[model samples]
Target: MTDTAIQTRQREIASEHLLFKLIEYVEDRHPGLLDFLEQSLDHLGDPADDASKDDAGVRAIAQRMITGARRQGTD
Candidate 1:
């Protein structure tokens, strides 16, 4: 596969991993956290979307997820 295609696939995998981790976290702690994450993810739109490939956009989405997870973990 092309490098770009490979990178996209990797990002998708990472996103899935993050989603799984979020779900696991909710199961272990606060159920409401999942709802917040789902809202955040929805706001992020499709990872494969052209705008999502922009470096800043990707970082923003990842950062948001990480921040949400960290906040949930601490609570």
Candidate 2:
């Protein structure tokens, strides 16, 4: 695969790992958390179209918000 394709696949794999690990950690306590999250996304979502570096500033801000929230371990 090309270098870009490899990197993209790596990012997807890593995202999947993080998502499943999080579900496993809290599924027992919440019981329906997985279903809740899947359902909630229908109400809250970003663009699903192709992105470009032209929006890197907005993307970077969103990334920081997510990473910062993750560090706090709670909303």
Candidate 3:
């Protein structure tokens, strides 16, 4: 694949991971979170602006995941 294709695929994976984490975090409070996410799947993504800026949304997820891991003593 070309560099652009690889970048786009990586961006899509990162967005999917972030969305998965979000639903996992809120599933207890919102019982239908998974179903909602499945129905509104297109809503998840690293936005075009953020993607242009080097996947800032994914970076944010990395930071949050680190914080959460540290808090739970899993880091």
The Cα local distance difference test for each model comes to: 0.64, 0.57, 0.58
- In order of appearance, the predictions have TM-scores of 0.40, 0.49, 0.43
- TM-score ranking of the models: 2, 3, 1
lDDT of 3: 0.58
After superposition, the stretches of candidate 3 with alpha carbons farther than 4 Å from their true spots are 35-75
lDDT of 3 by residue, 1-75 (tens): 999999999999898667656656676556665455445434445656633654546555555654453344311
lDDT per residue (tens digit) for residues 1-75 in model 1: 999999999999998777857565665676575456555653553347554466556557656665666655632
Off by over 4 Å in 2: 44-75
What does the lDDT read for residue 53 in candidate 1? 62
- Mind sharing the TM-score for model 1? 0.40
* Clash count of each predicted structure: 0, 0, 0
Writing each residue's lDDT as its tens digit, candidate 2 over 1-75 gives 999999999998898668655755676556666456544443453444656433545555445544443444422
Instruction: Please give the range of 10 consecutive residues that has the lowest summed lDDT in model 3.
Output: 66-75
For candidate 2, which ten residues in a row score worst on lDDT?
Answer: 66-75
lDDT of 2: 0.57
Best-to-worst order by lDDT is 1, 3, 2
Question: What shift in Å separates residue 61 of candidate 3 from its native position after superposition?
Answer: 22
Off-target runs (Cα >4 Å) in candidate 1 are: 32-75
- Which number leads on TM-score? 2
